[model samples]
Target: MSDIATFARVKRPVVSTWRRRHPDFPAAVSANSGRPLFDGAQVTDWLIATGLGNAAPQELRSELALFGIIALRNRFTPWQLVETLGSLLCLRRLDGRPLADDGANASPTSPPDAEADEALWSALLRRAERIDAEDDFVLRELRAIDATAAPLARLAEDLVESAYDERGAYEWLLAARSRLGLDSLAADAVTPELRSLLTQLTDLGVRLERGESLTLADPHVRVGDLLAALLDDAEDRDRVTVLAADPDDRLTRITRRRFLLAGVSELDLDVQTGSDLEERFADPYLAGPDGPAPSSD
Candidate 1:
C-alpha cells in the first residue's frame, strides 16, 4: 500500500482510503514481514485505468514500475544498471527489435519469461560488436553484465519505452545519477546552475545554422554533460562535428554513446580517450583575432 501511494504520488492515508473505498484496487500479492505487498504492475495498471493518480502518463508508470523491480532485485549496482541499460537502449535503436525476442529488451508490456537468456546475450554481444566494431561504446559495458544480462535488458526496454526514444531514455537515466547512488561514480556533475551557465555560454543556435555545423570540443567530457548541453541547442545536430577527450575510458565510452544518441554520426565524432595536450587533429581551431573564421561561426 505504501508502494502504491508512492507510485500514485499520493499520501499514505489516501492509499488506505483507496483500499477501503475502491473495491477494485489490486489485492495484496503476498506478505512481507506482516506488511502486505501489492504487485507493482497491478497497482500501476489500476492507477492508469482508474485515472486516480499523478502517475497518469504511461511512460512515467513504466519508469516507476521498472525502478521498483530494480530495487527489489538489488542485483546490479546503480552504475551497473545505468551502464547496462545504456547498451540495451543503444542496441534497440540500432537493431529495431524487441530485446527479449532475441535477449534483454525491457519488454515492460510483456509477461516475464526466461526462455533465451544465453542465446539473447550472445546475440546482443554480436550486435554490439557490429554496432561498435571498435569496441568504443556499448561492448565493454554489455560484457560486464553478461552473466545476468536478461533482467537488465528488460529494464532497458522499459527505459526506452518510458522516454519514447533512446536519447531521452539514456539522458533520463543520467539525470537520475544522484538518485541511483552514482554520485561517487559520476564526474563533473551538471547541476542546474552550472548547466544553465554552460548552456548560455554554448548558445550555438545561430552558429550551428550559419556554418552549417560546428565542431564543439570539451576537454573534460565526463559523460558528455557540457557537450550534450550544447548539442541540445543545435539546429542541425547531424552536421555538428564533436571533438572531445577524457582520461576516464568508461566515461569516454558513455560520452561516445551520448553523442551517438544526440544524432551526431559516428563518422563525424572525433572523441578520444585521452587528453589532447598535443593537438592531434589537423590545424586545431585557435581562439584569437588572427585565427580563421572571424565570424566565429
Candidate 2:
C-alpha cells in the first residue's frame, strides 16, 4: 500500500488532469486503515482519465451497473447499455492506454483491428468469470439484489454480462438461473446452439485443468455451473467437506480449492440453496486449515 504521497508522486499528473476538467475530484481517495476505497464512480473516472481501462473486474461490474441504471432512466435499451460497457472495457484492456491522455490512443500499428474486438471481448469475459469464480464484495451485492424483480435486474445483467464466448455465456446463464430465480426460463435462454457453444468452452476448462492440449471441439458444460446446479436440486443435497491439501497454498486460484461435496446418490435429487453455497464461499475462516468445513457447496 503506497502512502498518499507516493501515489501522488506517480499518479498525480493523471489525477491533476482529471481534476482540472472535472474540478470536483475528491481531495484524496478515501481509505480505511490504509487501503483506498475504490468505488465505482472513482474507478470509472480513473479509467476514463488515465485510459488505463477497467482492470478491476468486480468493481467494473458494479460501475457498469450504475451506468445501466442511468440508461434505464433515460429510456435506453438495457441490452445496448451492456454492449457499450462491454465494448469499452474490452477496448481499454486491449489498449493498455494510460489515464493521462483522456483515453485517446492514435497508434495505428497496434494489434490488428480484426484481433482487437476478440481480445477485448475475451478480456471482459475472463474478468466476469473471475468475478463469478471468486465471491467478492460485488458478488454479494448482486446476490442480495433481485434479478428478475425491480432495480437489481439491470445490475444482475451487468454482473452476468460479458458472455462473449460460449463457455462464459453458458456459465453466466446457469449462474443467473441459480442465483436470480430465472430457472424456469433458463433453458429457454440457453438454446441448443448456445449449449453446443458452451460445451466447447467446458471442454477447454477441463483440458486446462488436466494440463492437456485444448483442441477439442466437443461442447462441455462448465464444471462450476454443473456443480452449482447440482447443489441447487433438493435431491442432490449432500453432506461433504472441503479440504485443502496444502494449508499454505494460495486460495486465489480457481483450481486450488477443488471442492468435494459428498451427496451424489443415484436416485436422489441433492438440493441446496444458492445462498448456502455462497455463504460458505464468503467465509474467510473456511480458507484456513483448521476451520470447521461446511458440508455444502
Candidate 3:
C-alpha cells in the first residue's frame, strides 16, 4: 500500500493526537445539528441532493456519532468505503499507465485508443478494488450470518459516481469481464455444485452488464455480481433500493417519482415528511431482532 493508503488504514491510533493537532478537521466535516437550518430537514435535503436519501437520517447521524463505539467493535479499523474519492484526489499520479522509453532501443508511440483504455481502466479497477477491499467490514459482518445482499445493495448506490464518464462506463465493463474470469477460474477448481454456482454468478454479472435485472436470482447473488451490473449505470442502485424497500404504494410512488425526475432512487425515506430516518440500508444481519446484535458484556 502507498503511504497515504497505509495512513488511512491505520489512522485510528492517531485519532486523539490528530484531533489535538488539528481540531478543525472534525468541524470541517461534521454538521452541527444544533445550528439553525442545519437540523434534520436540511441534513436530509443535503443527503438527498447528494444521492444518499433521507433513509434514516437520524439513525445515520447517531451511528456516525457512535464512531468511537464502531471503531472499538472492529478493533479500530479504518473504513475505506470507495477509494474513488482518494484516487480522484491523486489522479495525476495514479490514473495513467507508465511510459516506457527505449524498448528495443526506442520508445514505441502509444496508440490514442490504447492510451485511453489504460487510463480509464487503471482508474476504474483501482477504485473498484479499493471499494471491495474497504468494504471488508461489511462483508465479514454479513458472512457471519450468510447474508450479503444488503451491503451489496448499499455498495451499488455508491458505485453511482462512476456513471458520468464514458471512460467509467467502459472501465466498468472491463471490471465485469475480469470478475467473470475470476468466477470461471474458481468454478474450474471446485466441485460440480460449486462450479454450477459460480457459473450462475458469472451469468448474473453478464446480464447486469447488459442493463438487466438479476433480482429474481438475488438469493444466489453475490456482491461481485451486483457490482458488475450497477457500476456504469446510475439508475441501477436506485432500482434495487426501490425493490428492496417495501413494495408499498407510498414507497413505489416516491421511487417512481424520483426515477422519472432524477433518474435515481433514494432508499432511506421518512415515514411522513419530517421523520428521522434510521440506518436501514445495512445488511440488517447486524441489526435485526433475529439477527446478530452487538454484544453487551
Q: For candidate 3, lDDT tens digit of each residue in 1-297?
A: 121112233343443453356433233223345531122223333443543322343333322222212222232122221222222212212222211110111111122244443444444444434443643212222222211112221222222222433233223322332232334323423244644554464453455456643221111121222222332233343433212222233322222222222323234221112222233443321111122342221
Model 3 poorest ten-residue lDDT run: 99-108
TM-score of 1: 0.82
Report, for every candidate in turn, its global Cα lDDT versus the true structure. 0.70, 0.32, 0.28
Worst 10 residues of 2 by lDDT: 213-222
Measured by TM-score, the strongest candidate is 1
How many residue pairs in model 1 have overlapping backbones?
A: 4
The alpha-carbon lDDT assigned to residue 95 of candidate 2 equals 30
Judging by lDDT, tell me the better candidate of 2 and 3: 2
For model 1, the superposed segments whose C-alpha errors exceed 4 Å read 56-59, 103-115, 185-187, 277-297
Candidate 3 yields a Cα-based lDDT of 0.28
Better of 1 and 3 by TM-score: 1
Top-down lDDT ranking: 1, 2, 3
Backbone clash count, each prediction separately: 4, 18, 4
RMSD list, candidates in order: 4.1, 18.4, 22.5
Q: Per-residue lDDT for 172 in model 2?
A: 36
